[model samples]
Target: MSNLPQSLSLNVPFGAGPSGVVPGGAGSAPAANKDRKMASAEQLVLDLSNTELRENALLELSKKRELFQDLAPLLWNSFGTIAALLQEIVSIYPMLSPPTLNPAQSNRVCNALALLQCVASHPETRMLFLKAHIPLYLYPFLNTGSKTRPFEYLRLTSLGVIGALVKVDDTEVISFLLSTEIIPLCLRTMEMGSELSKTVATFIVQKILLDELGLDYICTTAERFFAVGRVLAHMVAVLAEQPSPRLLKHIIRCYLRLADNPRACEALRHCLPDMLRDGTFSACLREDPTTRRWLQQLLSIVGGNRVSPLQSGGGFEHMMVN
Candidate 1:
C-alpha cells in the first residue's frame, strides 16, 4: 500500500510494462491488486444488500466488545460510509411501516447498537443518526400494533437504542430531537409504555430536563405552573399511582434539581400537595436519604428558618458579617 503512490508516478502509462506492470515503475500491478483486494473486503463488511450478512457482521463486531478502543479508528475512518448505510436502511425500511426485525434480528441490532454506544466518542457519527431523522422513524413504532408480544419487544429494544443515543451528551442531538415534538411524544410514550419502557422513557426525559436548554424548552411549552400544572400533576400522579421506587427516587431528584430554579420551584409548589398526597414525596422520604436532606434544605430555603435535628441545646444563629 505504501509503495502504490510511488508506483503510480506522473510518468506512468495506463499499463505498458512487464506483463502487468505500469510504464513508470516496478511492482505497480501487485500493489494495485492488493489495494483492490483490501477495498473489496472493506466494502463487503459495509454492504447492506444482504441483510443477513450485514446483520451478522454487526453482531460479530458487537461481540468483540473489548476491541472498541482499537476499532474506534476504523469506525471513525468509515463513519461516513456506515452512516450512509444506516440512513439508507432507515429510509427504505421505515420503522413505521409494519416493522422489519424479527425477534433475533431485533435483539442483535439492539445489542450491536448498545455496544456501539460504549464508544460514543464519535459524536459526528451520532449526529449522522440524528440528521437521518431517526426520531421520526421511531415515533410510530412506539404505538405500533397496540404493543403486541414480539412487537412490543422490538419497540422496547428500539427505544433502548434511541434512549442510549439521547443520553450520550444531551446536547449533541437532543435540541434537534426536542424541536421536532419528540418531548411530547416521549411524554405520551411514557404514559402508555410498559413498566420497562416507561422506566427508559423516564430516564431519557430526566436527562433531557436536567439540562438548562431542555428545561427552557419545557418552560416555554408549559409557560407557568397553571399552564404545565396538569402535565406535572399527571406525571406526579402516575408516579404516585404506580409507585416504582426507582421512578420515585428519580422524580424526587428531578424536583430537587429543578427547585434550584425559582420558576421551577414555584411550579413544583403547585404540584407538591398532590405529589405529597399521592405518596410520591413520602416514597422518596422513606427510600432516599438524599431526598431527606433535600427536603430539609428545601424547608430552609422556603421557610427562612434553621431548625437542625443534629443541633442540641440551642438553635444555630444566623450572623451577618459586615
Candidate 2:
C-alpha cells in the first residue's frame, strides 16, 4: 500500500525525495515529513518477498518521472538492491555467468526489468541505470537460447530497454552504449536470436545507426565508420547461411538507416553490390516488395543516386531491377 498523502500532489519537484524533497535540500518540516513517508513506502515494497508486489509498488512510484529525475541520488542507491533481486530471478550471479532462468523466476525478472526500463526512459534518470551498470545486469537475461515461452519473452524485454534508451536521445547513454559490448551482442542476436529477439535487436541496431545522437558517435572517425560498415556486412554475411525471411527483412531495414548517413553510406558503398547480389538478399528482393523497395533505396544511395525519402520524400520507394 502507498504511504503517499492523498493531498500531496504528484506534481512534486523534479527530484523530490520519493515523492517529496531530498534529505538535504531545503529540509523544511513538511518536506522532511514527506520524505520519511516516501522512504517508508519504498522500504515496505522492498521488503516484500513477492516480486510482483515489489513490481506493483515500484510501478506505481515510477509513474511519477519526478521521482527518478529529482531524487536521482537517493533513487540510484536502490540500483544495488535491484541488481541483487535481478540476480535471484535470472541466476546470472554478478552478470559474469551464463543465465539459467528458472520458470518460477522468469516472470519476476521480467517485472524487475520492466521497472528498470521505466526509469531508463527518463533521459536524466537513465544515467542512473548506466552508472549502476544496470546494462550488465540486464544483458544476461537475453542469453537463454530457448525461444519458447519465458526465455524469449525475457530477451525481448531486455532488448526493449536498450532500444528505449536509444530513443531517449541522451549523449551520456549513447556514449556508454558505444563503449560497451552491447553493440556486438545486439548484432549477434539480430543475426540468429529468437524470432522476437531478432526483431528487438533489429530495432536497437536501427535506432543506433539512425538516431541523431548516435550519428556523431557512429561517424566520429574513419575507423568508427568502417566498424559500422563491417558490422553491417557481417549481418549480411550471416544471412548467407540460415537466411531466415524475417531476419533478412530486419537487416534490410537496418541498411535503410545506414543509407541515410553519408559516412555510413560511403563506408558501405562497395559492400552494397555484394549484399544486393547475395543469393539470400536477392531472393528476398524478388519475393518481398518492402524488402525490394528498401534495398533499392540503399543501393541508390551507395551508387550515388542519393535518393532520400526522409529528405525529398521522392520516388525513393521505386524498385530497382538486376
Candidate 3:
C-alpha cells in the first residue's frame, strides 16, 4: 500500500510560488539583499551540525517567525542531513522500547522538528518534508517519554507538529500521507497517548477526514472507507467509556465537520445503521441534552432506514419518500 492513488493532482511545484520571500509581504527585496539572506540561512542550516550553533540558530529563527517561513525552502534543503543524523541516533532504542532521553540528540532533533513544523504550512515545504521522509524521522519522538524535561518537550512538540501537518487542503499531501503509516500512528496516539496527545490526534483526525482529503474521494476507496468507520467507532467508544468534557468536545467538533460533509455522512450512514439499530448510538445520545441535540443533528445528516426525518444537512427532503 505504499503506492499513492493515480487521481491525485499535485499543486504546481514550490519554485513557482515566488522568487523570494517578500518581507512582511510588503514587497520584493533587492537581488543583493535576497542573496545575502539566502547565504545567511544556508550557513545557519550548516551550523546545525554543531549542537551549540544549532540551538542558537533555532532560537534566533524562532524570534523572527516570518523569517522562518521565508527561509522554509532553504531549511528544507538541509533537513536531509539532519534526518540522516537523527536516523543514526534513534536506532539504539529497539522496538517497543521506552526512550531514554539522549539530551544532545533530543535537543537537536526537537529543534529540527520545530523548524519543520514552522515551515510545513507552505505547499512546497510540505512536499519537501514528505519527500525527505521527515515524518518517519519524527516517529521515534511520539512513542516514548522521559522524566527528563527535554525528552518530554520533544514528545509534546512532535504531537503538535503532527497535528499541524493535517491542516493543509492539499489532496496530494493527504494522498501521499495515506500511503504512509501515519493513520495507524494516530490511532495508537488516541489509544495510549497523553491527554495533550489525544487532543492533537483528534485535531489531526478531524482535519484529515473532513478537510485535507475530500470525503468523496475517501469514500470511493475501500480501505479508506473502512478506515473512517473504524475511527468513528473508536471515538464513540472513548466517549462512552470515560466521558470527559474535553474528549467529548473533540468528538462533537469532529462530527460538526462531518455534518457539512455529505459524502462522508453518506458513508457513515451505510455503516452506522447497525449501531443505530442496536441502540449503541442511542446510549451515547443520552449522555447530555446539549450533546444529544448535536447527535440528533448528526443523525439527521446521516439518515438511515431507521434513523430518519431524512432531513440531513445536505437537504435530503425526498429521501424519506424514497
Q: List, residue by residue over 4-113, the lDDT tens digit for candidate 2.
A: 33222235532354746455555588666666656554553344334556655544544543443333333444424455445454453432234455554566566566
Question: Residue 55 error for model 1, in Å?
Answer: 2.8
Which model scores highest in lDDT?
2
- Write one digit per residue (lDDT tens) for candidate 3, span 1-322: 1252211113322222454343333354564455455556555655555555656766555455465335666555553435534543464445215555566756655665667677676666777766766777667666664445655566667766666677866666676666776666666666656666767876677667675464554454556555655665666676565555556556665665655655556545645534433545454456577766666666667653543434333323233234
Ranking by TM-score: 1, 3, 2
Tell me, by TM-score, which candidate is best: 1
lDDT of 1 by residue, 162-224 (tens): 676777766856688677766665565566667677667667766777777766666553343
lDDT of each: 0.52, 0.60, 0.57
Model 2: number of backbone collisions: 3
User: CA shift at 133, candidate 3, in angstroms?
Assistant: 3.0
lDDT of 3: 0.57
Worst 10 residues of 2 by lDDT: 313-322
Ranking by lDDT: 2, 3, 1
Clashing pairs in 1: none
- Which scores higher on lDDT, 2 or 3? 2
Which is better, 1 or 2, measured by TM-score? Answer: 1
RMSD of 2: 9.9
